[model samples]
Target: MKKTGITLCLLAMSVGLTSVVSAQTQLPNSDFEDIQSISGVADNGGQPYNYEYDSLGQGWISGNPVNRYLEIDHIFMKDTSFTHSGSHAIVMRTDSIGPVVAVGNAGLGEFVFNESNPFASIVFGAPFADRPHAFAGWYTYKSVGGVAPSDGDDRLINGDSLLILCYLTKWNSTLEKRDTVALASWTSSETVTDYTEFMIPFNYFSSDVPDSANVMFLSSSLGYVADFSERPFGVKGSTLVIDDIRMHYSGAGFDEYAELNGTAYTVGKKVVVRLEELPSDASVRIVDMAGRNLVSRQLSDKESTFELAYSGIAFVIVRSEKGTLTRKLYIH
Candidate 1:
């Protein structure tokens, strides 16, 4: 069973910071209704095979490598047959493409496939900073086995489970590396014929604010089980259908809603934050609705004020060794 500790060095290297004028906590196109058609050619033995498939619209990416030198097997596709809401949902299937049998996987980021070096495949996360309480979604799965290996390996086993995972990350300037602020992961092997709701609460490991978030879905937890050549080995015909993915802010596991001995209010174009007693490591961060940090600084005094450039709603988050407090600031 592959866990979340896989080295994301390639993923971190692909991340580039971009300025956002505004932000939103909700993910874009979560319903999987919007889609784009992709066409490509793949190597079928020594001949070329042409194919096309539907990809997740925008704000989402899959590791499917079409138009490659090897036989193309689409791991992700749009499914209309089984959906919790709307007209479409996402379907992932484990498939065999020539010498490789890979599990379907998708993430909320950008993906770049390296043909010469599959291990060098890169996936960088999108900009997100909000710390939600839990990640919620709907999904259904069916597991199947029996696929022969081209390399004369053992037949694929049945009852492989699927995985849904999300993580919050922050860049540590002193350590010069990305650190995980929170993580939520869920996996199951039980077959579900109908769409079922699921929620996974985040486990925070740091008091610092995150700068990015990564959400991923996989048809099999053992998708990354590589053979001697580093090719993924998995059971074919395993399918997972998912839709209506969202983040929940107010819930039982939320730590950001904890009581704090502080007050925050908007004064003119600036937001004022005052704490009764400031801890030595206490810090304040002001972010827009889309989770973009407007101001982030350590508290040197009991009271501090930050000026805002834009109007509307923003969040004032104060974190310390004691706990975390979040307040809303409306600038008109």
Candidate 2:
């Protein structure tokens, strides 16, 4: 139930400009290793003038409202004990002070808070022009069964869910608005005790090149209702720990092979891949929308078919020494 109206504010300012990146790019501070303390107190009498707040490192932004009226800080915290790699990771938790439940969220862009109307608008996205095929990362989630808001989506009433999402956008001069070129989103309610890898493929909506990219992680997907009220939605204890986020780009060899010699299609609950001449070291992997690998095997023949046990949107990936190619599939 996150609001999309705030995206209109992005038109007022130009984000940091950078050279167009074409290769696979790992976001700055993707590992959450750089920890820094940002000291600030709420401006509208939310806290004492002497109070200070610790925030995330550079290249990441959060809507924790440390400078706002609520002044919630527990939404984002540094975690060294439960990390996937390196010495640090971030744990985003659904936090509440009194009846105000703030959903834990961190992204790549900046946020603007209007203390007058009490509206927090986020200008989400950083300058980038790459059309990466997939967004990959590692994370662990622990959900505390909480009731969804009365006006929220019914599907989330059972419990809170963690969300990871990325989108590519371009400002359309003709339309005078931002156009979403591609998007990849994943949400899960299951409790994961150990860190698990995830790769979500972007679904292209337009053929136009992108000028900005945004990636975000949220501890509770149904906590948006608390934005305008002091009433809580999701449980305060639900948490998500994440580390090592990266973007996946298609290699040249994979592109050439796909255009000339390979083809992939879905038939019912199965995926069929055909390569005129399969490489000896090539392999095929099938993953669901949640980035869970369902099938992986070496390519022994020019044409191979794999039966899928689950049905939904899936990705068919072929990997070899030449490169990696991915195809989107829809199985009914």
| Candidate maximizing TM-score | 2
Model 1 superposed RMSD (Cα): 14.2
Off by over 4 Å in 2: 1-19, 40-50, 65-73, 116-119, 146-157, 225-232, 251-332
lDDT of 1 by residue, 1-332 (tens): 00111111122122533323233386678877776666767687998778655566665766653222335445444445777888777777777555455667777766555555544454556677777888888999987755455676653444667778777777777887676666666667778889999887665656766777777777766565222344555567778888999877864555453546878999889888899888898888775532334787898988998878868766677777787666766797
Q: What is the lDDT of residue 195 in candidate 2?
A: 90
- Tell me the tens digit of each residue's lDDT in model 2 across 139-222: 899888756655764645677888787877788788776666666777788999899998876666557778887777778765
What clash count goes with each model? 2, 0
Off by over 4 Å in 1: 1-24, 39-51, 65-79, 145-158, 225-231, 252-332
- True-structure lDDT of candidate 1: 0.65
